[model samples]
Target: MAVAPQVLPHTAISTWSGFVYQGKLALYHCLKLMSSDYAANRDLKLQLESQDDFAIFRRQQCLSMHQVKAYKDPRFSAYSDGISTQRDNARQRGVALAYFHVAREVTNVPATFVADYGPVRFYTYPIPPDAAGNVIQSFCPLNQVDMFIRDELSSLLVNAAMQPAWKNYIVANIQNTLEAIVNLKVIMTHSKIHESTRHQTVIAASEFIEFSELYDVIEANDYAPFENEAFFLSRLQIDIGTYYQEFCERQDSLSQAACQKLDDYLAAITSLNVEGMKAFLRATMPHKKGRFKTLSEFKDQSLDRDAMRLGMFTIFWKLVQTARNDGSDVAFSWLNDGLFYYPTGIHHAAEHQESICHDIMQQAISEDVECLFECGALITSAIDRPSISDVIIGIDATEGVDTAEHELLRENRIGNYKKVAMISLNNVPESLKDAEPD
Candidate 1:
């Protein structure tokens, strides 16, 4: 839903893919208010300090300055990985406060503001995965009081660039702030997504929005697991599974065929004999027995299910395209499913796809039938309107043949093709000129 910077038809679903960084900042603000410490305040009033992106406060007293920096580039240190430099910056801010004597002037400020000192923390979204493939939150506590002045101070001197005295003065001011900067912390914002806390957030958010469309809205807004922390965290006491079931029941446009396939797929996955499947897969993938074994251990991982659904959808889409081309008159069985749920437009669904190959691969590994997979895929890829297939391919041939990369490239490619297809459809000739017609 948050595939690009556009709005979905007949729905409030709109997205700004470029504003990912800004959205994270907003998420951070909501997270701060969700904190137990802030919420427990008898008079929990706060204001936004635009000095940094946002500074958290309560009762006119500032607590922390949240500087959100999204680092997707491999060269930069991700917040999940915890870097020494980020910690050092936090330490430097603390040192600067001491050196500038700004903390001492706290009481001299106006009554509208509290001169309280707080940590300058950097928050990064999409916390990187650890060796175990789990999202990890990294927090570095840099103490200004504990840092060795001689070593820390000397490290700042670049003899070729500046004199030691000047560097010392600069580093001192930067490290110690008149704000009495506290320790720096680098947090992985989405670290708890797979945990119970995330379930709680999801359940709570459903209270304000339809549970069926809650994730869709959050995902479309910024791809953050939870867009508004305050609303999502409000009803944390609800039963997540129960609410989710209720949400699913209310989804109006889903095709019965799609639902049936989903049920069968889930049943097949649940009924798998992990040990038997591992042994069976090991005969051909002798060296990768461990991979199958590990996969078997996690019976229905949401991510794996999503991927499976995508595969199913892609295959079904190809069938639909073939059927449409052949001019089959059997009205589509899952038209509603295809229209409301899928991620891509009808014309662009399965563009650049090798659906037959996927069908074979899926049949080999899954107990579920290929038709079931196709139905699932069709439902997932559904768009708002049904149109003739666009001629544009989802990705350039030069982009390489990786499936994941193709899916990524398709996000950008599919939108353009849909626009072209719509224009073509709208610009039909005034009347069909037959051989007999002038």
Candidate 2:
């Protein structure tokens, strides 16, 4: 029954955690339905006859019912009065009963229940130690279950039934019960398969009717929450081969939908350009060398387009410092076509419309005059004390260098001139001294 949009409907909290919890509950119920229905499909009915967390079952002509418990914690406490009551209830109701827990460690069966019905068995998790290094206390492994059940049933049959045909029927019923238990384990382990199968079952059940209306009808009838579980079983029976193929297709579609939703969620949080800018800054930033000169230097000041300019200035200062410490001057040719060299004239002529290198350098040089002055001091100390003429003329040249369009070309040429000047000022070689006075 489709709900009318004009009518007020039931209200519920809209939260992701709620969705997750509800989905898990739905999956649990669905698995239970599949387990029961699959047993019925095999000509055996394992009813959901218990309200507590247990699988209670009895087969045709069988003298014993089994209660199966699957749980996380493995430490089994002593048999409680509650279990004894359940056992008495089963006996009073004309059914013999036994109980088993899935994990290792279980209390001893009540002596009265054993005398009245049969021995309680334990069906545990696999043999390998779990995360906490504890093996489940199983009556026997799955491989051993067949022989174990057969032998136990034989003992029960010795006095319970004397007729051959009746004994055979009871044995067959025990086999059916074991098969159901095995199938239940398989379903629990491969939960995805159970979930997918259940989804198809629910969808098929609601094909011609709105699920909400169907749910409302079921609730109004005072039936169980999943009243239409049998409906899904009927739907699954129609062409199971087709149903499996459709299930694979639906699984593929779900994978695609999940990926697209993830992409949409990520795109909603961040812009493409912001990501690109971050990439640029990470690639260009100067890496570790020396410790910072001041605490203020530890804070990031590069947040905008000027970040690249600041990065270059810092790198240039480091280069100058390294050269001074090594007692060697760097050749201008060494920086040719390198990251620090700025050739705006050539860049502009090529119609490359990105941020110009010369402009970046001008901004960097103008803003970091203290760093430039320190570099000049280091350069002077590394070579020789500058003469009055050298100091006066060098400052005049430095002022004009930042304003030039082809700053790298001029800078490289000026480096060659400085090298020549240093050689002349220190020691004029005999060959050059004898040649001519420039």
Candidate 1 weakest lDDT stretch, 10 residues: 178-187
> Candidate 1: TM-score?
0.22
Candidate 2 per-residue C-alpha lDDT over 1-438 given as tens digits, one digit per residue, 9 for 90 to 100: 985453111111111111111222222222333333432322322322222122233233223333333222334444344355545545554554444433225445545654543444343333458788976545432233345445444543443323244445455443333333333322222232223433433322211111223123212323233223222221211112122222222332333333233222212211112223222222222121222232122222322223222222222222211111122122110121221221010112213212222222333333321222212211110122221122223233355444555577456434532332111111322321212111
For candidate 2, the 10 contiguous residues with the lowest summed lDDT are 338-347
Using lDDT as the measure, the top candidate is 2
Reference-based lDDT, each prediction: 0.27, 0.29
Per-model TM-score, in order, reads 0.22, 0.21
Query: Can you give the lDDT of residue 321 in candidate 2?
Result: 17
